[model samples]
Target: FIMENCDELMPDYLNFIKGVVDSEDLPLNISRETLQQSKILKVIRKNLIKKCMELFSEIAEDKDNFKKFYEQFGKNIKLGIHEDSTNRKKLAEFLRYHTSTSGDETSSLSGLRLPHEGEPDRPFYYITGESREAVANSAFVERVKKRGFEVVYMVDPIDEYCVQQLKEFDGKKLVSVTREGLELPESEEEKKKFEEDKVKFEKLCKVMKDILDKKVQKVSVSNRLVSSPCCIVTSEYGWSANMERIMKAQAFRDSSTMGYMASKKNLEINPDHSIMKALRERVENDQDDKTARDLVVLLFETALLTSGFSLEEPGSHANRIYRMIKLGLDIDEADAVEESTSEPVAVPKVEGAEEDASRMEEVD
Candidate 1:
């Protein structure tokens, strides 16, 4: 009954699990470290991982128990998905997320699409944020949710890294809703309608693009906008706002590289939105309309916040908000702040004569 400590056979993620094995295929007196070199032990390790995956599947059958297990040990699963290459697919099955439809409840990656037979084969659409509540209310999911598709809300700190590694599951590509090119499988009629809208809104989008030339790579009529007027989205290869924050927080990240990557963002405008229609009218009336340009700047800044990107020019953002407040209140723009003066105070008739020494010093 010699004790064996073969912890090295297991991944650090599974260190919480304890197990013992007795085999007569190898000598009993062999040290555990030396036995690790044995091909038999390597085979045993492979089998152990397989068994562990099977055990997880069984545990998942009982949803309540698995929820408890996941809440307690879920970080380990995420770490495993990120660090374990050979077993990523198996570990991905254990991934869970809050969703647009699941109201505080969580669903697995496979459950992130419409549950109908005749549904179009959609990719696994998801949004990452600082937390579940933040993503639940994001502008990115508006059209997807309106189209009856569920979106995975990836809120954990490590969820992005884990999903980046997983990439896909069950043959469906995991795509971020915040990515610029979201090609929904539209019917022919829908495509024609979108084409018409694109033509109608082309000039307006161009105006917005020119207004935000330095801040955004492009501005176009959006397929993803249902209720929101606009949103900022990253390019296919660019860092998302969440990923940017993570990398920026790293002590060793290159600022120039990050700046270049972060610059690749686009704005998507809702053709049907009232503000958009009014702005288009304003633009048509005058291409250099100061009010229209100001409104575009405000819209872009607001979209930055709603789309999870921090404002690079917060001072300008604040000033723009103040201007909006003034407009809403119909205050005169010519009203400037009064200047403070350091003119000498005229002590009126010396009520107590306390300033006599200061007045004498000034006279001197």
Candidate 2:
């Protein structure tokens, strides 16, 4: 109807909209300016949204057709969701994503939007990282998926902020499992046990924080960690590791402000991990051992790297590693070797041919 009636009068693209343009009982002779500013435009927009949502619902019902449509216009739908606040929920229905559970390839939106009791009851759970493989294999999502949760693999640079803007969808919250404010259930007994472990590791945490030169906001024991000894987590309302990676990858990154926007990470040590347990014991028993201190620094550096943060002093980290290796080899710390200094051999200047000839003539 739009093309037949308005094609000659409007842009070709605008004519592509397939809908009836009704302006209520207004007079047909109404002025163009009046018609353009009428309340009917809003009503038409609302009706258009409803119609689009209905079309999307029909498309979503068929898996194969939905996949084909998503292949052709998924990005447009995602952009619509990002830009149109009123139709976000409708547009989100058509968006597809790659998931950890669905192998490496992309899957339909319905697959990830479904609910599971063991998994988070939210409409969607997702993780963002540098790449699909990184997000899929992230330590943060390991436990979430182990319980059969379908986590959306967000590899795009804009995805994190886009998801943040979309706090909820269809009465379901969009949960980021990596955020520091993540909600994990814990029994009273478990809470008490964690607190006790925190107390035990308090001194070690302090030493690490001090040696780290305030790079981390704080250090605390984490229950989220299972196998890893330590990992970095941002504070509430701060950029996640994935967001930080994205910001850094930009061509013209504003380091000073981005440094501020990139939340100061907190080093979360897993008390249950052998490395943390051993470090706690060593800090208490052999606190004076230089080797133990080196180990602590190494652990901090390793966590920084894993969390997608750069080391403040890479040279110091290398030196600590070298010292640790030297100690392991039973080498003396004070062992001195004489330095070798050799001067560069100078190239002798050749006499000019003209000067040599003059000299020869003088000699003759």
Candidate 3:
């Protein structure tokens, strides 16, 4: 045996690959000093890693066995994506992900490779969350999915870390669908239409921004929504909702950095949604309309959840929902808190009880 453990050579996750590594090139009586600093051992280590990668490739060809192998070591590959810089590209090719279009199946990066003939354009879209259900049900995918495009769903806790190192693959940058300024290539007509809507909703956007001034960075027309009214999205490189949740779950996370890490999110409203149309009319009529302001705040809160963020002001959100219910039921808005109609219970012979206690003490 060359050595018992090769954690320094092999990835920590691949420590399970145990076997007799007999090298004729390595001396039989190789001392600890030689083991610590041997060029031959480094070469052998490199060859072993290459062979393992080749083994992974071979196993990948067989879907059934690969599933079992991957179940045991898939996280290792994800970890390697961040930890192994030498073979990151090769490791990325082995990556299997459940995309919006893959249904229950997973696709490799090679399978979804987009054309990279353009001038460094066309980014690969991805979404990160706590589970498949959470990732797939996000409002961020509405328009992207509507356009017959697919987004990789990253549900694992370590996925965010893996993806940070996998910034780009084969010239295409990996981008999250839940970030601001995500503009897909569009036709001139579509671009013109978007600009026209932006012009039309200028006043509404201003009013919404003013209402959500403290809660959001800005309110603008959405480029990623087809059916949803609004959604909260982080800045281009801001921490994702999943990442934020993971950080908060950590016992030793720095609270000061959390605020910095959360960064600032911007609210986006779909210009074509019916709610937006009505809200625009209300804003045009009166920017300070109480109903319009309430609706705006409520939409922002709901968008916070739809985009996988916890509400910072749940109490206010609840109150707004209650107000909506009251409005729906035609309840009077000015109703005051009801006073207790039952009279306060009279003190039941408390004075006599004190006098009796005093008489007993005197007798004693």
Candidate 4:
């Protein structure tokens, strides 16, 4: 029937689609042409999808078989999360990844057994990076893990994008705990301090924001960062680092609409970080100093690179490093680098080696 109704049927999409088409109006399906327009075809397609999803869900419920299914069809599940809004919640339930709580191994959704009452069930949070090791050891996840939060190590390129589309799962919000807009509960004292700091650094923050206007949507002091001086975070609605990486790796680099949808990121500096503390002191004491200005630029550029964004001016960072080194060494910034010259040097050459002798003579 499919072969005969090739003109009406979508053949490329029919492969592996196994189902029966029953039409009440057809005389047991009279002819291929007659069956092509049968209203039963629509019902079959819907039923087939429902059956497939049910089968998938059943398989997903089986821990042993779901592992095998995930190994083979995980990408399809991730793609569904990206493309199918209506079914994203269902697809997310099937997705799995390694988490700190999983204890040095990977686990599935069915296996995410939370701790009992009186024990904190810090739902597994995660950040995406190029490697699991990197994500696991990142500064962003360090504090989260310290607080006993189980962070899923999402190294896969699609993991971040897929999770973003799925905002919640099993009554828990899928959160990028590294995002600047994160609202971790803070004490009244900490909140008051944060407000005071914001007021104190208002001018410097404005200046930093102005300088980074093109690359960052905004600049603000963050409570998320602990050890790291600064980090960058995307807007709640923007593409994440992993999404940007996946989009940029596509075959047709500039073709995808996702490339255009990617927006500028926000730079979040830790006010308590030593680097920022020093910067704040310097800005308050001598805001117009060239050295302080250079440090600000360096900090912003470093934040960009650390946050998975490319440096706009690599040379500027290098020069800033040189200047900082000059300051550290108490050397004149103008004379930081010694000029290269072909000046003669006193050196002895081996006898009976005329070419070596000439080379030594040139240096002398």
Candidate 5:
């Protein structure tokens, strides 16, 4: 019974703790594993977990101590929140993350998004990547940040999955900046102007879609970009490029299982950029022009790379880049002349070499 209670008391998240319970009063048939199924043992387990949670709550109230403790075992706490449905909400309150607002400090994900006046509805925006700098520098955050949105930087591998499990916090939807359904408000004139621009670039968007048919779900004018020429965004229900990259890296993950999550992404072109304007003019004038087609392909591929999506054909991308460089240098395809080899130097005929060989053959 004592061993059973002790076993029950240790929470899964605290499995790193090791201890032994000894007692003389034990039935010969009752094994250590058998004692684990005891009803009374279950009660002890629940009580122990409750007490630990209370203690953690108290520690959380103390910011310095909690920070120190979190720095040590925060990953385990996040894991517990992910695995333990019963205590997920409670564990989540204890979670902390880094945000643009915090600078070097950390803040709770729920507290990051506060109702601000004169701002678009601030859904809890987050950007996930391999590192904090990667997420910070992501094209995904560029316009969002300019538009006054606070983005949570999730650098850990488990961060994206945790956000997925969380879905929402404190009445705000946790929306990834890289995912679809991003909307921004515009004035009537701005809206009218964009509609006109859309019409103007309709041919360009169509040609872009055709060029990237297999690589992208579609091409459209971007409402999110402020300065970037283009970026990629996933479908509303599809996995972010970051999540897809993470899942694909798992050695045991099934590729077939990822099909639904790894759906095609939309390429968003910033109509305000000169490149977009030039491409539009070119497409409108001559969609079939090889230079315009090459530019479209290059832009789509550059957007793919910058938007965190891995290229399906890296060699092709490199070749396209090489062609663009050659074009920039005015080096025509025919200008790539192969190096000449010196005519094979005639082996100096040794004086009487054939005569010596014939004499040796005769001697043999």
Candidate 6:
């Protein structure tokens, strides 16, 4: 009976419990209440969890079968990581994920390869997104990949929460690619170039910070962006854009608290981009250029949207876009008439509709 109802006997995190246990030693008078409160039952449950871990370990030894098992019940294991504090490390061993090294294949966290180098091993990198393609093509992953690091693609929504619970696995800290503190190994020449760009773009960065003061924590050149013009990153201890989206979508969550928690983000511009170079020149040459400042604000807001952060002033963004559209089409804003706010005239009642209504009322 316990085997058949193992889900009931086990905790919610262990709901995937299967198989049978036949023991003549259990008391025949073991009522449901007794099973609930008995020390013997506690021993049985502890033994059962141990056996389950052993069985999973055996299954994981065979890649094909483990893949099947993970596909069928991986989310439950992630839930166990979040709920089972006693076996969190063991649960992490069973966690399988899509990693960059595996191509299309998935590998367990323990089985994945650590970076081989003369230097110390870097933190385990991972990216969370709505889809595998979304994470794969992300600007955040570019620098990590360029540095020959493996990044786990976290497609499932539960994956983020799972990593949060299982913070560090096997002495390696898990770091999100979208968050701050990711330092790539740079050559001396590259370092010199970065320093030059920082000094050269210092005023431009300050101008950007001023323009986007309320929306972003700061504006600076990014080490992560290789191809993309700009991207947004969160503070080391703050919630990520993905996390912010998840929290904001919670129906019962307090908006005011979410606002406070999700407010600040950093705008990271690719200083190598041509537009960035031109903007730097423009800012240096004419710091008071309204057009250049508007462009900076527009780029910042666009990056905010692309980086999965919500826009606080979408209407302002739209107006800027409209202005750009006019500029592109060679339409002068000076020639455009302002939209009228005069009260619209109500159409005169159709000639005999009132009389017809009166005749109908008289007939009734």
Against the true structure, whose TM-score is highest?
A: 3
Candidate 2 vs candidate 5, lDDT winner:
5
Q: For model 4, what is the C-alpha lDDT against the true structure?
A: 0.70
Per-residue alpha-carbon lDDT of candidate 4 for residues 32-114, written as tens digits (9 for 90 to 100): 44454555655555565566778987886677888887787787778778876766776677778898777655776546655
Model 1: per-residue Cα lDDT over 1-364, one tens digit each: 4545666467788877788776777533455434536677678778888989999999999999999999989999999999989999989988888888888688887666553558545577889889888887888888887877778888887887887788888987888999988977678998898899899988888888888887888898888888899999998877888988778788998988886777377898988899898888889889899989999999999998998888888999999889889889888877645456668788678665768877988999
lDDT at 323, model 5 = 90
Per-residue CA lDDT of model 5 for 5-80, tens digit only, reads 3444567686654445454543333454444355555665676677778988899989999999888888878778
lDDT by candidate, in order shown: 0.83, 0.71, 0.84, 0.70, 0.78, 0.82
TM-score-better candidate, 1 vs 2: 1
* lDDT (10s digit) by residue, model 3, range 60-168: 9998888888778888998888988998999998888999888888888768745344534677889999899987888888888777667999998989899989999
Query: How far in Å is the alpha carbon of 331 misplaced in model 3?
Result: 1.6
- Candidates in order, TM-scores: namely 0.85, 0.74, 0.87, 0.75, 0.85, 0.86
Candidate 3 vs candidate 6: which has greater lDDT?
3
Instruction: Please report, as a residue range, the 10-residue window in candidate 1 with the lowest summed lDDT.
Output: 27-36
Candidate 3: clashing residue pairs, number: 0
After superposition, which runs of candidate 2 have C-alpha atoms over 4 Å from their true positions? 1-38, 105-124, 187-189, 251-256, 286-289, 311-338, 342-364
Clashes of each: 0, 0, 0, 0, 0, 0
Show where candidate 4 strays beyond 4 Å: 2-38, 61-64, 109-124, 255-260, 326-364
**Model 2: which ten-residue window has the lowest total lDDT?**
7-16
Cα shift from native, residue 102, model 4 (Å): 1.8
Tell me the spans in candidate 5 whose CA falls farther than 4 Å from its real position.
1-11, 17-33, 36-39, 113-121, 339-364
lDDT of 4 at 333: 53
Pairs that collide in candidate 5 are: none
- Over 120-184, each residue of candidate 2 has an lDDT whose tens digit, in order, gives 55556777777886666566775567655678887766577668767876667877767675555
Error of 6 at 240 (Å): 0.9
